[model samples]
Target: FPSAEHGLSADTEEQLRMRGCELIQAAGILLRLPQVAMATGQILFQRFYYCKSFVRHCAEMVAMACVHLASKIEEEPRRVRDVLNVFYHLKHSKGKRTQVPMPLDASYISAKAQVIKTERRVLKELGFCVHVKHPHKIIVMYLQVLECEKNTKLVQTAWNYMNDSLRTDVFLRFSAETVACACIYLSARTLQIPLPDQPPWFLLFGASEEDLREICGRILRLYSLPNVSLPSMLKEVDQCHLALDARIAKAKLAGGGLLAVGTPTLDVPSSFSPASKAGETGAHHSPIGNTLCNKNSVHVSFQKKVWKKHCSLLCFIWTPFWVSALRLTSLSVFRRSRSVSSPLRSVSPTHRQKISRRDREREKERERRRERERERGRGRRDEYSRRR
Candidate 1:
């Protein structure tokens, strides 16, 4: 998975994947979505994690979004509200078997928005190729070809195995046809029903014995493992994420020279990396959360290419329309936001001089008025002395 490529451990990533798949399966049952939808949802969850990291996304939220997207892809759509309600109870039922569902409040609204946004992210990552070819029907077809369709026990066993295998990464690694053949092989072995060893039946179906054994081994491992608790898995993922964030924050602090080389100041952007700005050296980079493809690529501030790319993006971000609409009233505020860089310069020099002159005149008038008041006080004091 892409997460493993980053920093997530193998065991943690595997658990999170399995837990997400289990959540999808359970939510599908509660929402009355088809098995194909559940399987598709699980596959999508795997594919997404392959692109994103576990530290970057909440596994539970992504799982819910995958199920939501999968339902729509399968044309068995469930509304966001229904999906939310089902998951709310499913998550809340940790202590109580009959946990009450959460009401449609601000929290639900926020969660609803997250699910929608996450769905977009999933679709974006998958490039809209949401088509999932399930091996459930393939297993049936291959069994029929083998004339074992009459054996309900064998058929059901293989079918269950196919579903269980979805919780693993076998779908992403192996083809649907191979998975189907492998399921048949395992089912026959479990029932002690001998198939043709002369030619090794799976080979006829394009699945080698090595592939079948690998898939079967993965499926069997799932049985040996304990059931993953969704809430606990989420907690573990959150902890890992928090640790990662802290590490990244530390790296950023270390790299940016904040409190490392000097005290932090307002001109952090310009002075953040003085060495790079002076063309002395490349800016230090944090290795914690860099780009997925390239981790060691620190932003070279002295490089014109990097600055130009960022400037281009900023140019699109803050057009005149946005800058005019912003509540940047003070000159200091304008100076602070690069979006409205040097608004002070926009005023003509003559206009600035006129404003400075007007301020000087106001100060002189105040001084003259104060002198007159002092004179009147002296006159009163002199008259009192004369009377005395």
Candidate 2:
């Protein structure tokens, strides 16, 4: 799709993708699909949208299609009707009608059709590459290899992190093994579980420290908690204001004692008031006569001069062309008016008579030429008869 057709900025598109991920998780729960199936469906949804725009496609329909396709790909086939029924049930439960029975109504039929149509589109967008190797299984396997399988807390937390990671584009950006290692490492750190740091555990999974750090940072930012110390934050804000004032003062000094035009002047005490000094300075530097209020008057005057010069130049270049065009148009209009008023006004009576006489003479000359040609042909035929 063209960039304009996406109908979303970068930030908005990311937010939409995050919302889609949440819906995918919710739909998976509603349908009671396994964890792997849910993860697969989320991956498929993200991949499809990487090449498609959310504005042109309905998110709910695409999410439903992803779940449906995931069921089949994961070898746990669920009918389209069942999936759509679950969606409709969840949708109505939040509204006034909580006990609406699923029927073969128009809405239900239309939803089913949409799901099927979006399912094919999703598959085509993915290039039929529906098989996604998730980091969940890899995390479990690695936990076992590290002999940390018995730590249920660590394993469970890492598993949750892996699920959360699907909401991001990390799946498309990084390899499964790298993501798996990062999640496991983060889980261990969160739980304060010790690991052998001599060789760094991530190296075993072929993940660089920088990649792991980037992944962990993204996960942290996703789950960022509110600051608990509000007083410290306020103090930092005050310090920032003071520093900004200092920098502004320094800039004024560096620029030959000329303050920024819009800056508010500082008040002075009566004993050491420099009002006269300020007035003198203003008289010397102000753009208008002895007034500081018209600081922008200089710019306005310069702009007026530039505009006048530009207009003059344009008139110089285009005046003759416009005048000639207007003259030609007026002449054509006058001719048209004369013709409309009286066609004979276009030519004098004498000129008309001369034109008619020339035409008659030309016609007679043409007739004489044709007669001579016919007589010559007859003479040729007579000579041929005599020879025979």
Candidate 3:
């Protein structure tokens, strides 16, 4: 195990952190809960790298696994089945037996599995560096540096703003010290958080003045804009977020509401139903509560038959509910949801009786309205004839 004395050089550490952060941010944004899961994955990543030496390929797998692992650690965990499922789905494979692309074939899975199996080896090599210093803690320290009195409304707003910045790449590239300074700087200037003297090293982080200006500018843009829909330029970033959520939700449903990532099934309660999001009402769910798919894989079987509607090009389309929710909470759902609608047989006993009843009531209401309109039209016509 490497000690603090034997740790990697600061430059090397920055590169590793940057790499790890990229994977985590990408996965989290794709999965939804970008800030929360990214923070969780970052802690795991720093600890993992702090111990064992870096092997280029193994490091990538460990980073992916760290994110896969951290998602479960946070309340929003993705299923292993979903992870493997997407790996297959992207290739248009029907099952796990299908061959993957040349480079990321079974060999890749084997390599990743090896890393996962011996993750404890890497952990042991790191001298058990589980505890991590987070940006939230640093924000508290900087608040004291600025002699901010308490977690008042102003203090809370600044803290929340700093948390938002962490979602972007800037926090990963810059040190906590530099980030703390910039955050305080930006917060004081934009949010009007009072600061007497600017910290000296605010201008001396590894990032160039141009980069820092851009980072701060994005943060400022976020603050100034009145929560408007982002323009088309940000679609890829938005799509990544949606894809991640669909991957997780599909896995959970397949796994019966628990996602197993190299471990036993952990219970994740069902929140949003895919059917409801697809505008399918009165469809019976699987016998299991939110357990819609295979626990080990993404193959799902529902209780009732569902008509298959394939919009291949629109497979990644987000439901309006998903769009609105993600707009508010920033959760993404990339897959087109599956919903079952009532059968078309108007009088078939096999069809839902309630549905037929509702349709009849609607038809009667429409007929009444049509009759009233015809009466009004006749009266107008008669008045015109009399005037003539």
Can you give the TM-score per candidate against the true fold? 0.66, 0.55, 0.34
Q: Model 1, residue 274: what's the lDDT?
A: 53
Better of 2 and 3 by lDDT: 2
**Cα miss at 148, model 3 (Å)?**
9.0
TM-score of 3: 0.34
Query: Per-residue CA lDDT of candidate 3, range 1-388, in tens?
Result: 2211233344433444554555566656656655666676766765665555442224455666766766765667676545444333433443566655445677767755764665555456555544434567766766775567474765676676666564344554566665555666666676565555344434443434455566677566544533322122134324434554565677677866443222345664466667565334422444443443244234433322232444432444756666777676642222111113323444345355767788999999999999999999999999999999
Comparing 1 and 2 on lDDT, the stronger one: 1
Best-fitting candidate, measured by TM-score?
A: 1
For lDDT, the strongest prediction is: 1
- In the predicted model 1, the residue pairs found to clash are none
- For candidate 1, the per-residue lDDT at 24 reads 92
After superposition, candidate 2 runs with Cα above 4 Å error: 1-5, 95-97, 224-388
Residue range 272-382, candidate 2, lDDT tens digits: 557567657665665574544465667789899999999999999999999999999998888666655656663556556777899999999999999999999999999
| Model 1 worst lDDT run, 10 consecutive residues | 287-296
User: After superposition, which runs of candidate 3 have C-alpha atoms over 4 Å from their true positions?
Assistant: 1-13, 84-105, 108-112, 126-129, 137-182, 189-193, 196-388
Q: Rank candidates, TM-score, best first.
A: 1, 2, 3
